[model samples]
Target: MTAIATVTHVDLATVQDGGRRGLAGIGVPISGAWHRSRYLVATNLVRGAEDPRQPAVELLAGSMELHFHLPTTVAVVGPAQVTVDGLPFGAGVGLAVTADVRVVVDHRGPGPVYLAIAGWEAPLVLGSAATDTFSGIAGTSLRSGVALTGVAGSGCSAGAFLRQGDDAGGPLRVVPCEDVPLPVGPWRVQSTARSGTRMVGGAASSSGSRPSRPVVVGAIQAAPSGELIILGPDGGLTGGYPIVGVVCSADLPRVSELEPGEEISLQPMDVPAAMQAFAVAERERRVVHPGVLGRDGSRRGSVPDDVAPAK
Candidate 1:
C-alpha cells in the first residue's frame, strides 16, 4: 500500500473512474469523467486497470502539489504542463515517480487533468470509488494534507502520446440534430458549478417542445435561460433542456481541454467523418485498456477554473 500526501491549499482533486452505472434509472446522475478520452489515456498510461479496483485522480482545474511516499508510475492526460521537483515531466506518458519528489500540475488546458496511480486503493461507493459531489458521496475532496493510498507499480513503458484531432485547429466538430437550430460560430465558456459539464454562452434558447428530463451525455440542449448547456461524462442523465445538437462523440474529449472564456467553435461533421473521429480516439484508448471504463456517476463538482497561469 502507498499513500500520496495532498500538499495543496484547497480541495481540488477527486478519485474518479468509469462512474457507477445501472443506477441512473433510479434517479442517479451518470457521473464519470467529463472527458472519457483523457480518462482512458491517463489511466492506461499508468497501466491502471479499468476494473472497479483502480481509480485515478481527476483534476478539474488549477494547480496540484503532491508528495509521493513510494515509487510508482503516474501520468497526466491533456494539455496540462507537469513537472516533478521543478523539472519538466511529460504529460501523456507514464513516468516513475519516487518517494518525496514533488509532482506539480500546471493545468492551463481545456479539460480536467487525470492523475492515474499504478493500482487501485480507494474505497467504493455504490460499487464505485468515484467522488460525486452532487450525491455527497465523497468523504471529502482531495484536500491539502490528506494522504492517498495505492499499490505502486512500474507503470507502462516510457513513451509520450498525443491528443487526437489537433490538426483541425480550435473548433469542436459537431453534427446538428433534426429539428434543432445549431448554434454557429465561436462560443465563450461561462462559469458553471455543476460537476463534469461547463456552460456555454447564451447564444440560443427556446421553450421548445422538449422534456426537461432524461438528457444524455454530449446532448447539447437549450436551457430555460435561453442558454445552451453541453453535458459531460458526469452530466445529468435527465434534464428539462431541449436537445438541439450533439457534439460528435470523438470531439467530447477535446471539449474537456477547453479553457474558461476561451473562444470555441463547433464545426459541422457528418456521420462518416464523425465515426472516423470516434475511431481515432478509440484507437488511442486501446493502447492501454482492454475495454472501456464504466460510465456511471463519476461527477465532478465546480472546481475553480480561474487559476492564473504560473509566473
Candidate 2:
C-alpha cells in the first residue's frame, strides 16, 4: 500500500480577515481541523496526478499570488519575478500542471497571488471537492499555512489543457420533478441571481420568486406537456418532486461532455425501453472505453492508453 504525502504549509497574508474567518469556520466544522499547508508556485506550471499515492503541490515563486476557494477556493502566494531554470514564467496566462513535473510560477507584480492545497479524496459528500460557497458546509477558501494530507489523483490526461477566455458551454440535463409540470421542447435554463441554494432530494432551491425544483437526468412522463430534467451527481437522494422523466443512464457521458449554454433535446421513453437502452449503452461504453474498468472490475484512476478519446 502507498502512503499519501501530507501538505506541510499554506500562506494567507493576501486574503482579507473576513475571508479567513469564513474559511476557518466552515473548514473546522466539517473537516474537524485544518490539515495542509500551501505555497505559491513561481512558475506557470501546475501538476495534477503523478501517481495515485503522491499529493500534487503548486510551487509559486516570489511576487505571485493565488486566489482559490476550497470546498470553495485554495490560494497560494510567493515572491515576484522568479525564474524556473533561469527561464521566465507566469507572464499573464498560467500554465497547467502535468504529472511528474515540477515547474515554477513567478510574478513581477508587487502584490502576491494566492495558492491553496488540500487533500483530494473521492466520494465527496457533494459532487465536488469544493465546498458550497453559499451553504457554509465546507471551507469557502484556502488560507496560508494550513496543513493538508491525502490528496488524490485528478485523473486528467497528460498535456491536457484549459485556456483562459475559452468557454466550455452547454445545457445541464435534468429530470422533471414528480410534482412539477413538465415543460415542452428544449427549455432554457434561467440563471438564479442568488447563491447558496440548498438541495433537497435531488432538487435545488432558488432565491427567485418561483419555487426551486429538483433536477434529475431522465425523460419526461408521457403527459400533455413533454418536459425533462437531467440530474447531476449532486442531486438529492430522495424528494417529493415527481420524476416523470429521466435521462437514460447511457446518455450520461454524452451529457457530461456538453459545454455550458449548449442545448440537448429529449426523446421520451417508457421505463422498460429506458432500461433496455441503458443496458445497451453500458455495454457499448465498456467496449469503447475498456480502460474505464480495471481487471478486477473496479474503476481505474488513470485511463488506459488503449482507450480512444471521445469523438
* TM-score per model over all chains: 0.79, 0.35
- lDDT over C-alpha atoms for residue 170 of model 2: 38
Q: Pick the candidate with the highest TM-score.
A: 1
Instruction: Give the CA lDDT, 0 to 100, for residue 120 in model 2.
Output: 36
Using lDDT as the measure, which candidate wins? Answer: 1
**Cα-based lDDT at residue 91, candidate 1:** 66
Judge candidate 1 against the unseen true structure and give its global Cα lDDT, from 0 to 1: 0.64
How many steric clashes between backbone atoms does each model show? 18, 93
Model 2 bad stretches (over 4 Å)? 1-100, 103-148, 151-184, 191-231, 235-244, 253-260, 285-306, 309-311
Candidate 2 structure quality by residue, lDDT tens digits, 138-222 = 3324343332333433222222111121122333233443454433344433211112011112222221223334333232223
Weakest 10 consecutive residues, lDDT, candidate 2? Answer: 31-40
Weakest 10 consecutive residues of candidate 1 by summed lDDT:
290-299
- lDDT per residue as tens, model 1, 127-187: 7777776767553357788777756554554323434333426677777776666776467
RMSD of each: 9.1, 13.9
